[model samples]
Target: MTSIIQTQELSYEAAIKMCVAVTQHAHQLGVSVGVVVVTPAGVELASVRMNNAPLHALSIARKKAYTAASFKIPSFNWQERLKHKPDTMSALLREENFTYLGGGIPIIVEGKLFGSIGVSGATEAQDIECAEHAITEQLNSL
Candidate 1:
């Protein structure tokens, strides 16, 4: 049997707003960063790399966002959960667009996973802070 499922997604405008907010927060922290927002299906809706951010940050940020959206959990959680399972971690790491980093966060509203945001370029803590700030602000505005 085939059945269709409908899911709510983050709008393009919202994704842009989130990316902008993350960029602003990164700037306020005196860091250049790359930010990405992805839909529930792991499709990137918006992304930005601040001037002087690391050249590799943009790709990492997108992968982080995709990981969070596809797995429905913060990217760091995967690292923590998989650390003790070497075999599982090795297998998961082989998956495309899967990153176990702190900067990726799933954006949930009213218990629904709408999408995700990822930030990179600075320390993992700083990147996570920027992503968290943007997601919180967006959720609060809802």
Candidate 2:
């Protein structure tokens, strides 16, 4: 067994950029939102709740990021994945900070999970759109 492992970490600067990107996209959609970035271990790096975004959005955004990072999948995927796994769903639903919302995605770096990003406060579709667009447009240099 190895005593050490190598990992790619998500920087605060990068996380901040992602939040800014999310904010810009939200502006384009004429909506307010909360955005969060978290490490693969589900440690929060940065977060933002835009003016007029519901207070609830901040917590939801955090959970969305945690869910994506913990599962190594988009948080929205849980919806379909849990449909036939009532037992699994029951257990998972009780896990702290786990969510099935459609606005979380893992931040993939060179085929590895560097971290995750989550967006909330808009419709699920809009939130997902912002998350994906931020990764494609702003995270290219990561």
Candidate 3:
């Protein structure tokens, strides 16, 4: 018997939908945020910044999403890893588009890594909450 591995695909529209859902929830909470959705290859699919969000937040959001998509780990864990290894952390910073922030998280579905979504410009907790809501509820629900 032979087994096949079916690759999970996340269309750009789906990624955008996830981002919108997360942003809407964040808005309801009175938290302005920037969101970035990236493919598994770390390419940005869609990005949005809430009204009055910081200009730097867009860059930070993209970096966080890229970091998560590239590393296949949440940004918070990346921060902890850096905390344990300052030298390594410094080295990682030298790489382009690497951010150890709370808003970056990978979107995993059916135990397969799909892509990533990042949220910023809000409190770290709120950012993570938005990301989680999108990944766990909206994205995964599809």
Candidate number of the best lDDT: 2
Residue by residue across 1-142, what tens digits does model 3's lDDT show? 6598655656888888877987899989898889999988888888888888888888998988999888889988887777879899999999889988898999887677788999999898899899888877765566
lDDT of each: 0.92, 0.93, 0.85
If scored against the real structure, what TM-score would every candidate get? 0.95, 0.95, 0.90
Clash count of each predicted structure: 0, 0, 0
Cα-lDDT of candidate 3: 0.85
Candidate 2, residue 114: Cα displacement in angstroms equals 0.5
**Residue 1, model 1: Cα distance from true site in angstroms:** 8.2
Give the residue spans of candidate 1 off by over 4 A.
none
Q: Which stretches of candidate 3 lie over 4 Å from their true place?
A: 1-8
Worst 10 residues of 1 by lDDT: 1-10
Q: Write the per-residue lDDT of candidate 1 for residues 1-142, one digit (tens) a residue.
A: 6598888999999999998999899899999999999889888899999999999999999988999888888998987799799999899889879989889999988789999998999999999999999988887888
Per-residue accuracy of model 2 over 80-116 as CA lDDT, tens digit each: 9999999999998898899999999999877899999
Candidate 2's C-alpha lDDT? 0.93
